[model samples]
Target: EPEVTQTPSHQVTQMGQEVILRCVPISNHLYFYWYRQILGQKVEFLVSFYNNEISEKSEIFDDQFSVERPDGSNFTLKIRSTKLEDSAMYFCASTGTGSPEAFFGQGTRLTVV
Candidate 1:
């Protein structure tokens, strides 16, 4: 079975730096999402993308955060400016039929210092 794949398992950046996290979701999935988890906190939804546009988003997705599918196979999340609070394990997920189950990647851990 195909699963979501994320690159550069971990990243470290400066407070004001820009960071791009990449993910290759399941090929047949139509719904793509980006979620984050602070070290010991609950998982939070950031945004969901479908049909080449944002389908839904949470308040956590602000001006500083943007997501795109530059290619049919890859989805990317770009953080314009990093902040300490932005550090978290970012998960890339996808679902084929909008079912309750979503496949997720291992996550890219970001650390802003």
Candidate 2:
């Protein structure tokens, strides 16, 4: 079975710096998304990208946040300026055209100090 893969399973960032999180989804998947969990909180959706463009985004996906598929094979999320409150475990997920379930990556834990 194929699965989503995220790099740098753990990361540390400064309160005022920028960060880019990377992910590669299963080759046959048709949709991709980003979700985050702030410590013990519930998972929250950030954005969804499809057909080379953003399809949907949650309110949390503010101007400071952006995503890209700079390369045909990888998807990335970039946070312009990190804040202590921005620390969270980011997960990359994907699903096939008719699949009802999304397969998630192990998650990249981000810590802002």
Candidate 3:
């Protein structure tokens, strides 16, 4: 079965540095999402992309955060400036058209010092 894949399963960065988290969602899925879970906290939705535009976004997705589907097979999240609070396990997920259920990737753990 196809699953979402993320690169650099773990990343360490200095505060104020930039980080780009990459993901490849299931091939046939039409909707993609980015979510983050701060250590010991509930999962939080960051943004959703469809048809090459942001379909929705949460307040956490601020000026420092951006999402892009640079090509058919790749989705990415970029943090322009990392902060201590930005350290978290960021997840990439997707769903087929009309499906409420989402398949998630293992997540990329970002550690900022």
To one decimal, what is the Cα RMSD in angstroms of model 3 from the true structure? Answer: 0.7
lDDT of 1 by residue, 10-95 (tens): 99999999999999999989999999999999999999999999999999999999999999899999999999999999999999
**Residue 46 miss distance in model 1 (angstroms):** 0.3
Candidates in order have lDDT scores of 0.96, 0.93, 0.97
What lDDT tens digits, residue by residue, belong to model 3 across residues 1-113? 89999988999999999999999999999899999999999999999999999999999999999999999999999999999999999999999987789999999999999
Steric clash pairs (candidate 3):
none
List where candidate 2 sits over 4 angstroms from the true fold. Answer: none
Candidate 2 residues 1-113, lDDT tens each? 67789998999999989999999998888789999999989999999999988999999999989999887779999999998999999999988898769999999999999
**What are the clashing pairs of model 2?**
none
The clash number for model 3 is: 0
Estimate the TM-score for candidate 3.
0.98
Ranking by lDDT: 3, 1, 2
TM-score, every prediction: 0.97, 0.96, 0.98
On TM-score, the candidate that comes out on top is 3
